[model samples]
Target: NATFGMGAISITSEREKDVDFTLGVMTTGVNLLISKPKIMDSIFQFMEPFSLNLWMAIVGASVGVSILYFVLDYPSEERKFSARETWWFSVGTLLMRGTDFAPRPSSQRILTAGFLFFVLITVSSYTANMAAFLTTNNLEKQIQSLEELVERSDFQCGTVKDSATMNFFKTSSKPIYRKVWSKMSEGGLVSGSKEGRERVRAGGYAFIFDYMINSYSELTSCETKMVGTPFRLQEHGIAMKQGASIKSILNINLLKIKESPIMTQLQTKWWENKRKCDFIESQPTVEFGIKHMAGVFIVGAGGLVCAILFFLSKKWFVAVRTKEKSAESDTGLEETLYTTDKTMSKEDIANAVKV
Candidate 1:
């Protein structure tokens, strides 16, 4: 009688001596299983799109460009303004809330136009990145490779005892695999894949098992995920006693079935159709939160402060100049009156002497 089962049943050299293995029914490999990462809450999560250094660079660029604009548009006596006014105008232009004054010189106008173009490009890029950052899930992966799994000490790793994956690790010649095998032999190995999966779901534990089963388990449970790329490439084959005549016929038919559309339909029916979890890959809804637009409000507040200071300084300068002019006019008028009195007195004395 032919024996067939849907377990791992890999066609290794050791197993080939006792039983015949038909063509691979399913291709799979060992994969790491861990709990799904939780979404972290951060107050400054909105600033995640750009690094601190990048943000600093942007600010530096704006300041440098503003200085360039001020130098290019230096004012004349007819359209005079303080250094502060020129700075304010340049900053306002950079922010796209342009100032009342426009550059009169061709060189200044050209520079201003170039700066506007730069601002346009920068603003567009920032907006697009911010939108993506707010709407997309950028979860940090806990483990990405076998090397990482070995390096991390926060979680204990395990696999089903006497399974194909366990045997692969135990027989491997590589130092990393040898180390993993030692750990597994000590206390990590579990009796069944189900127990290993349950340990993973409980957290602080990692399970190494067949990729196909891991994929199926992830679809069934929402809180568990298959992490990292597969380590050992292996195939599942139908098992039969050695020297079985039906092996050749079964292999031929298996190849035919694989080539047909029936295999794909069966795979879809088993994997996709039976998924228990409601997994949707839709864009996350983004709301206009204060954190998202904090920079805009901050810039507006800065401009308002600058405007207030500029108004006060202008008023103070005008007041001081007006006071100095009044003082000079009063002194000149007094001198003129004294000169007229002296001339009138001298004229009256001369007329009296002649008479």
Candidate 2:
């Protein structure tokens, strides 16, 4: 109830809070007079704060650190393991010989590592992009770059929800970040409605905040160009459970992927294609393409990889079964003829059976 009251007061307060020392002392004194336990007292002697605010500050810092580590660093599914469960499992593994405590044994580790690596790579690429953008002087234009953006003010820039783009806002803010959760929502791009992607493409908003490669892929199908330069960039690589043994394989795969010609070709195909963005306001198709190209590539690649793997595995199993049946048939003719015949000798049966 007290917390609720404080929250209500905070939300309803007309003025911004200025935490002066006088106000703090007055509040602490009033609480003491009201039969409240002295804020300075601590159950644990070592944990005691020098002052009430000092205690509060420590608590606040702990909460903030926890949020950043558990929430911001990874997806929710990874954090679903409870504190008690994680602790016991970890302790048991360290105590018990030949124990692997990791929840993700194989594929999950690979996927997580790959995802993080990709994110790191994207960040680095964006950083380089930002540096290049800053290097090329543009003194003549005031609102020349996508980096100089504001929400519902200048240009509408968007990102995918629960993505690194959302995390980017916590540290960097060169553009207004809007989240489009789905392909359909992205296609619509509604401003002030979480549909910023669709709106940006349609000229209801301007520019998108995404990885350079993603933007490049999108440009292949869309008219909206990745103008000016990248606002932010950092290393985006795969994530693992702090330390995992598959580091060598993960690193190798990442290096191979980066060096591949496929990625280069994809970049060219998307960026080199010319389209009329000036006429984007007139064409619904053009607008849709611009907003939705990035979304399509991501979804399509994920689906395609899954499909190919499934088909190949199915084909391999079929071939193995077919070969096994052929081998069994070849060895069975003599046995079949002898087993059925009561009057024939084994040699006669062997002679009589077809080769």
Candidate 3:
């Protein structure tokens, strides 16, 4: 017999029992590759970027700020703004329309600024987020996890027949892997790794292959990606039959290469080719939570508080001035009465005093 040992041989427990293997040179794992499809959305697709709570917040903020504006402007002497006018002003501002009836009160101004700032942030982020979702094609739903893949009836999977990947699925004690193997029995078994990849490329098929190739394939095909995390982590080594004399020699040389700087250089030669592809995964479709826009919310709340404070202070100042004027008028009237009493008799003073 001839020595049949080289790279690309997956080192596994079953294989190790029959043959000795050299130190692993390449590390890889099994993963599923599926084609990306365009997902159709409802008429309200524009709302996908932000959560429902966020939409409600936007509406609540707008209505709440407008009502507050009316409350502050109702009693103002400087502006003759009605409830209808105030509401229309708020709507115009939110819609990015120009309006001449800007609030004159200091507090109303602060509230408006805050509302405008929130609108600016929301509109800009919404535009960017919507664009990313539309372009990324992440809206297309497929089996995103192993459990989902197992339950998926529309998609089928397979691996290279009699290959290490196939063996792993076949011998795995995990119910999940066993179920996968059972499905493969129905069809999707390919003669070679290349054939398996081809079936995956045809669409509606998931191919169990090396994650290294999975990654490279994603780079070349922008519409494809790994369904879930890579499973069955393993290594490729020189596989040899039992009692091979060159085992020691092969192990020593492979270990040396693995430890030395040449390993890095060699890996670069294989993976770092002068090529690139467009990527959409991990780009958009990521949900924007409240924390992302906390600053905007904070600014708006601060403005609202400041506005309320200014409104209260203005009312207090006006009250104080009115009280002082009333007191001065009473004093003046009393002095005039006293002068009348001095100039006229008790009878004339009685008529003026009106007991």
Among these predictions, the greatest TM-score belongs to 3
Model 2, 128-195: lDDT tens digits are: 53354334322223333433433124333444444444444434443233222221133323233224
lDDT of candidates 1 onward, in order: 0.70, 0.37, 0.79
Error of 2 at 23 (Å): 51
- The lDDT ranking, best first, is 3, 1, 2
Candidate 3 deviant stretches above 4 angstroms: 1-31, 34-40, 137-163, 166-284, 343-355
187-270: candidate 3 lDDT, tens digit per residue: 978897677767776778888888877777776665577778888888888877888888899888888887898978865666
Could you tell me the lDDT of residue 318 within candidate 3? 89
Q: Is candidate 1 or candidate 2 better by lDDT?
A: 1
Q: Which stretches of candidate 1 lie over 4 Å from their true place?
A: 38-141, 278-355
Residue 235, candidate 3: C-alpha displacement in angstroms: 17
Error of 2 at 278 (Å): 12
Q: Give the clash count for each candidate.
A: 0, 25, 0
Residues 1-355 of candidate 1: C-alpha lDDT, one tens digit per residue: 5465446688788888878889998788888888775443579876656666556655765666556545544443335445676677667876779887876644445555555665665566567777776666444335766777777777688898887788889889999898777766767889897898888888878888888888888888876788788768877898887877778998999999988898789878988887887653323323334455456545544543444454456567768999999878766655665576765554454454345
